[model samples]
Every structure is written in C-alpha cells, then in structure tokens.
Target: MRFDKYNKKTRAETEKEMIGCLIVITCALVYLGYETEWGTIRL
Candidate 1:
C-alpha cells in the first residue's frame, strides 16, 4: 500500500512538470509568431 502511494505521487509530479513545459513552449511560439515581420514584408 505504501509503495502505491509513492508511485502515485511520483506520477503526478512528472505530469505537472510536463504540463508546465508544454505551456512554456506554447507561449514561446506565440511570442515568436507576433514578434517577426513575416506577414508585412513582400517577396
């Protein structure tokens, strides 16, 4: 029973970290999309 509880806690912590990383990456992509002048320039 004790081992099961520890496993659950570890799994939750890993999931939280993954979510935080995904959010950070998503924000970075959005910021880059708006920061560049790709749409305003002509070829």
Candidate 2:
C-alpha cells in the first residue's frame, strides 16, 4: 500500500515535470517563430 502511494506521487511529479517541459518548449517555439521570418504576415 505504501509502495502504491509512493508510485502515485512519483508519477504525479513526473507528469508535472513533463508539463513544465512542454510549456517551455511551446514558449521557445513561439519566441523562435516571432524572431524568424516564417511566422510573419505581411499586409
């Protein structure tokens, strides 16, 4: 029972880390897109 609780906690932490990484990656992509010419629109 204790092991199961520990495993659940570990999985939750891993999920949080994964979410944080995804957020960082999304921000980096946005930054790069703005800095690069690909994400631009001209009127």
Candidate 3:
C-alpha cells in the first residue's frame, strides 16, 4: 500500500514536469517564429 502511494506521487510529479517542459518549448518556438518573420520583413 505504501509503495502504491509513493508510485502515484512520483507519477504526478513527473507529469507536472513534462507539462512545464512542453510549455517552455512551445513558447520558444513561438518566439523563434516571430523573430524569423521580423527578420524576413527587414530584408
């Protein structure tokens, strides 16, 4: 029973970390896209 509880807690933490990483990656992609668009307009 204790092991099961610990496993569940670990899974939840892992999921939260994964979600945070995905959000960061999405923001980075958006920033890069905007940068490229501006660069093209300037050229």
TM-score of each: 0.56, 0.56, 0.55
Backbone Cα, N, C clashes tallied per candidate: 0, 0, 0
Model 2: lDDT to the true structure: 0.68
Tens digit per residue, CA lDDT, model 1, 1-43: 2446557567668778889999998787776664456562222
For model 1 the local lDDT of residue 5 reads: 50
Give the CA lDDT, 0 to 100, for residue 16 in model 1: 88
* Candidate no. 2 TM-score: 0.56
User: What's the TM for model 3?
Assistant: 0.55
Instruction: Show the lowest summed lDDT stretch of 10 residues, model 1.
Output: 34-43
| Residue 29 in model 1: lDDT | 75
RMSD in angstroms, candidate 2? 7.2
Model 2 Cα lDDT, one tens digit per residue, 1-43: 2446557567668778889999998787776664445655322
Model 1 TM-score (2 dp): 0.56
Residue pairs that clash (backbone atoms under 3 angstroms), model 2: none
Task: Give the runs in model 2 whose Cα sits over 4 Å from its true position.
Answer: 1-9, 34-43
Off by over 4 Å in 1: 1-9, 34-43
